[model samples]
Target chain A: MTNMALYKREMKGSIKLLVIFSAVITLYVSIIIGMYDPELMKTLDGFVEAMPELMASVGMKADAATLLGFMVSYLYGFILLIFPMLFCILRGNALIAKYVDKGSMALLTAAPVKRRTIAFTQMKVLVSGILLLILYSTILEFICAESGFPGELDITSLIMLNGGLLCLHLFIGSICFLSSCLFSDTKYSIGFGAGIPILMYVLQMLANVGGDAETAKYFTFFTLFHPDGIIAGESQAAVSSLILLAGAIILYALGIIIFDRKDLHL
Target chain B: MSIIKVERLVRDYGGGKGVFDVSFHVDQGEAFGFLGPNGAGKTTTIRHLMGFLKPASGECSINGLDCWRERDKVQANLGYIPGEISFFEDLSGTEFLKFIAEYRKIGIQNRREELLERFELDPRNKIKKMSKGMKQKLGIVAAFMHDPDILILDEPTSGLDPLMQNRFIDLIAEEKKHGKTILMSSHMFEEVERTCDRIGIIRKGRMVAVDAAASLRERHTRSYTVTLESESAAEAFAIDFNGMRKGLKVTVTTKQSLEEIFMNYYGGEKHDEHGAV
Candidate 1:
């Protein structure tokens, strides 16, 4: 019940940020598509050629070239990943470290609630908030698609893609939650939480560049949530995404267990 | 029956800090004060009682329910006001209070309104804009609004004005009359002296003494300032007073505590300068 309350609060606080980001990104993409209709194919070709480098940089897949693939790669790849990463870091940092930093945990912990309940509620709030953002972004994407910009994208496939992104966000959220448990300082929590995902993103890109190190893709969450893999209808990446999602749950559970036993100073 | 009990509760920080093997008990409906100097483990003990930190060894229980294992059930019966009041700055006082009430699964009802009025808190204001006293009042209101069976407060009056502190004392007195158990941790000796029935003094994380306030004062060395008609009488009384007790020290003084002089001067008066006798 406490978790439910915290989740509601997190969602309430972040809805505006999520809505604004979604509208801005969607509107920007729609305008670009409308103004440069003649150069659309040229731009699409350039985007495809740059896909590998872009994917390497952002830990996305290089194969998204078709209309559906372009939308997923352009919209979901860089924008979706960065936005949720920011949200997860912000939410996770606030949940535990912020409370400790501000001395509010003393007030909360002084209540009859257990430390584990507090930690668990925070994780729940963060994950739920990320889910809300994902839902909003997916709605925006659908709206933009319906407005006739990307005519060939399938709604069902887009839903599945968003679902995969949701799992990936959960993965990142758990990582951030774990970092929060490890670091009592808010600055350290945000730094470490945001740093790890970006570091993993870099690692995945390096592995892609090596080509022979294909197995390294399994190590990073970004590789699992790659837009091209989903658009290519590769069941393997879907399975990998599920595995990463499971890993996230396990990480969060581990954090909760540790937090339950650890002494809190607030 | 003891409403709160701690038996040799050890909470050691990795570097050998915090409370170590400290133990005490508070009977039901008792207003217990936990007195300690800074870093004397008062907050540490309170945290253990709240189940925020597990005891390194031994146990802490509330109404016979283990605080660690039965946390939610134990917490459901508790109202807590922390030493430091750090609320969600963006939320209005009412919003923050409502959020807490919702988590506790209770309706604010009239309790919220009553507390706000009593504390003179404006619930409409954002928490960030409120003064420290106002913030403290908000915390007090939130904690008390639930009307829990037990209140575990840590320096609850740190930021309150003297008038508000007096009101808080009266509130605690009222709560005590209604048979609510209170465990208050504070460095404010006078407040403890005024509000608590029993006082526990902890020094360096170990409980130095735990007894009824009057009894502890009596058992410990009492200070008596005697002002005689002459210096000879004052010197004679000091020697006699010192000889009567093993460790007692007596001092002859020309000056008296203003409170003592005021009481003596106003004795048996029907009307006083302040309009009360």
Candidate 2:
């Protein structure tokens, strides 16, 4: 059984952040929907023909002028990746490292619960916030599409895209949370928590730089969730899902192990 | 039985900066004051007792449970106030108190409300907006609201106003009467003298001395100047009392004073100067 008091406090503290993140994603989806003018896809096709390298540099497909491809490049490609990843990195740090650095965690650790219990409850809150963010964005995307661009979206692809994103962010959050649990100093926690994720993003970007760069994809977690393949119904869900689940599990386990045994030095 | 027991605890942070072979005990219903200069291992020893630090050697226990391994069970009967108080700044004072209460699982808030009123703390203000003294008051309320049997307070009156400090002294006295075990670390000699049954002084990560409060007070000697009738009378009075005679005045000092012993024990500057010489 979990601690209800801790759960409630964690929820209350992060609810405002949760709302803001969800709003950004939803608003972004709506704006992208507004960009659709039915014939704009043809215009995009012409523009892509004019400068193939411009679209290719950002990993946008030259032929993706349909609703699904437009959403993939404009919405998922940048906004979803940057905002949610930043949210997870920052919130994950705040949950553990910030408390320890500010000495507020000393009060919580002095309570009757074991340190692992506190760490576990905070981890759950992080996961719950990510899940809720994805849920709200997915729902709003559906609503925005139906109202503004009815019959434009492919339902399966939309679900697949959100599902893949959910897995990816969980993987990101777990790594950040683990670093937070391992170090009592915020500098060390942030150095690893934010540092590693940004590195992975860069590796993925460099892998997309046209030629021999594609080999770098193998070194990044981004290769696990392929957006282009996901939209084309060519994604290997079992393999990607397993990697994400395993990464999340191992990282969270490491966090609990370290937090439970390590001295907080309060 | 001892409510808190620390035995030969050693935590070496290197550069001679950690507690070394420290040992002490606090019995139930006794007030023990821990006195020290800054970085005298007082906080480290207390952290060991609070189960916040895992000792490099030796161990600490509370109510017969190991402090580090059995912290969850040990904390049930303990109340603690750290040297520096930090709260969730976004929450109001009332919200923070309520959060502590819920964590403590107290169905009735009779004691909580009583402490709030006693401290005159308006709990509606956000924690970030509260002054240092008010924040210290909030820490006091949260620690005592649980009404635990043992209290570990570090520099508990540091930021308090004079009146509030007196009120806090009175509160400690009341708790002592109710058979509470308290281990308080402080720099205020007056407060320590007023409330503690025993005192321990630490210097440079080591305990210098521990003695009963009454005995220590008795050991502390003060020189008195007595104006005699004349120089001859002053000399005669000095002979009678074995005092120092200076014209019409005679001076006498108590022997084997605790303050003298304590001062000598924490003489780091003297040690450094001697080394220099």
Candidate 3:
């Protein structure tokens, strides 16, 4: 189904990008976890009360007494979403569109491998990069929580949150991958690959504002990821995560199909 | 039997572009040269053979396997050098070759080393830093290293120096001698003349001429005027040349070079200044 040599080459090419993103996410995760305090929440609540609408728009919550709640409210909303989305966009475009655009794809297709195999292998590289990123953050978050505030974080909910985060990004990553497969030119690939996710993020922001704008959530896939809901033990969280996982699988399969069938100028 | 075959292959890119009803075949152990200008659909037809494209109207096959449907089987023992050479730029030339070897699942490194020496390519420098000729040499090495039976090269010597070009011509000749079937698209007439058994000239996506190289060379005809010592001598000279005799001057027709034969197919002598092909 996939070519291992091609997979390894792609991994080597993007490992640096994976490391840099993971490092930055680790830094933000630790700082946010380290800042968890009962008193600070009261002060932040006072600030949140002062500008409730503005606070809601950015997804910052006031009542974060529990460690998991504090982490979800602080990190999941903006920091986790933005960084991994950026990683997906860049990595996805680099995988297929860049190769085809630069004409190096000729080398890959020139071999005995099937186009389906090449696309599948590249899709694996993308999925693996996204998995490793979320996995690294999960491990780092566990380490930071255990060392700083012993037994403060709920182990299961934290795992659930990260799992949901992984699905969300996988879904996002597939969108970028599909765009990459759809266009042979990097310009158009980056345009749609970067554009669609950024639009969804904007819609998520507008929905977070919580007013007449709350209806906007229905339009964006980001609404399926509920870090706060997952921590609160909501059944909706499990359903949404499954939906996101399914979406990722479907998009990836579609990308492989399109790549196998489409004419490559390379 | 035909090892590579195309039958009425048509791929329409709209607005008077793309190959139209192009058909040709290379028999077992035969060397076929595809000649055309830059936009004459030479690369387009070759791309179809490599299975990077699907023909809209007709079918092409290799070893009785459909080029598009059974491409993996067809390409398994095929070697190809694309018109434009672009590699993983960050990798050293040696690293690129190794990756190709691994992808092709080649166990022996002897042929790769031999080709590296034959092409005089160091391949220690990064591909991005390598000169154009070096990159072209690298492409050639990669294509031939696998020891595939069928070779499809598109303008294989585009960036090589004169010396390297001759070396490449020799390589093709040797490969042909080894009974390897080859279909090479080239602009260099001398290279084709030396390597290919037959030549196909395409113009604006149409094959204008396809014949044995010897026959094409026989078609190389030009006229020359001879000033004889006397009218009687001129008349005698005109009889052999199939030309006219007028007093002391006789207009004689004779055979020209293969290059001129190609030029005649590409629409007459206005393009005399652009003579490299």
Q: What are the DockQ scores of the candidates, in order?
A: 0.52, 0.80, 0.72
Candidate 1, residues B196-235, lDDT tens digits: the string is 9999877557786788976654443345553467656555
Task: Give the CA lDDT, 0 to 100, for residue B49 in model 3.
Answer: 90
State each model's C-alpha RMSD to the native: 9.0, 4.8, 5.0
lDDT of 1: 0.75
TM-score of chain A of each: 0.83, 0.91, 0.97
Off by over 4 Å in 1: A1-4, A31-38, A43-65, A110-121, A149-151, A207-219, B14-16, B219-277
Q: How much lDDT does each candidate structure score? A: 0.75, 0.82, 0.88
True contacts kept of each: 0.64, 0.83, 0.81
Which residue pairs show backbone clashes in model 2?
Answer: B219-B257, B219-B258, B220-B258
Winner by DockQ? 2
Looking at model 1, the pairs that clash are: A112-B75
What C-alpha root-mean-square deviation, in Å, does candidate 3 show against the real structure?
A: 5.0
Q: What would the per-residue lDDT of candidate 2 be over residues A196-225, giving only the tens digit for each residue?
A: 999988887777665898898889897787
Expressed as tens digits, the lDDT of each residue in A74-111 for candidate 1 is: 56646777777777877777777788778787656655
Residue-level lDDT tens digits of model 2 in B1-277: 8988888999887777778888888999999998765666888888888888888999899889999999988888888999888998988999999888887676666788888888898989999999999999999999998898999999999889888998899999999999999999975555687899999876666777788978766666568999989889888889989899888989987653334455666543532111000
Each prediction's TM-score versus the true structure: 0.83, 0.90, 0.92
Q: Residue B247's C-alpha lDDT in candidate 3?
A: 82
Ranked by TM-score, the better of candidates 2 and 3 is 3
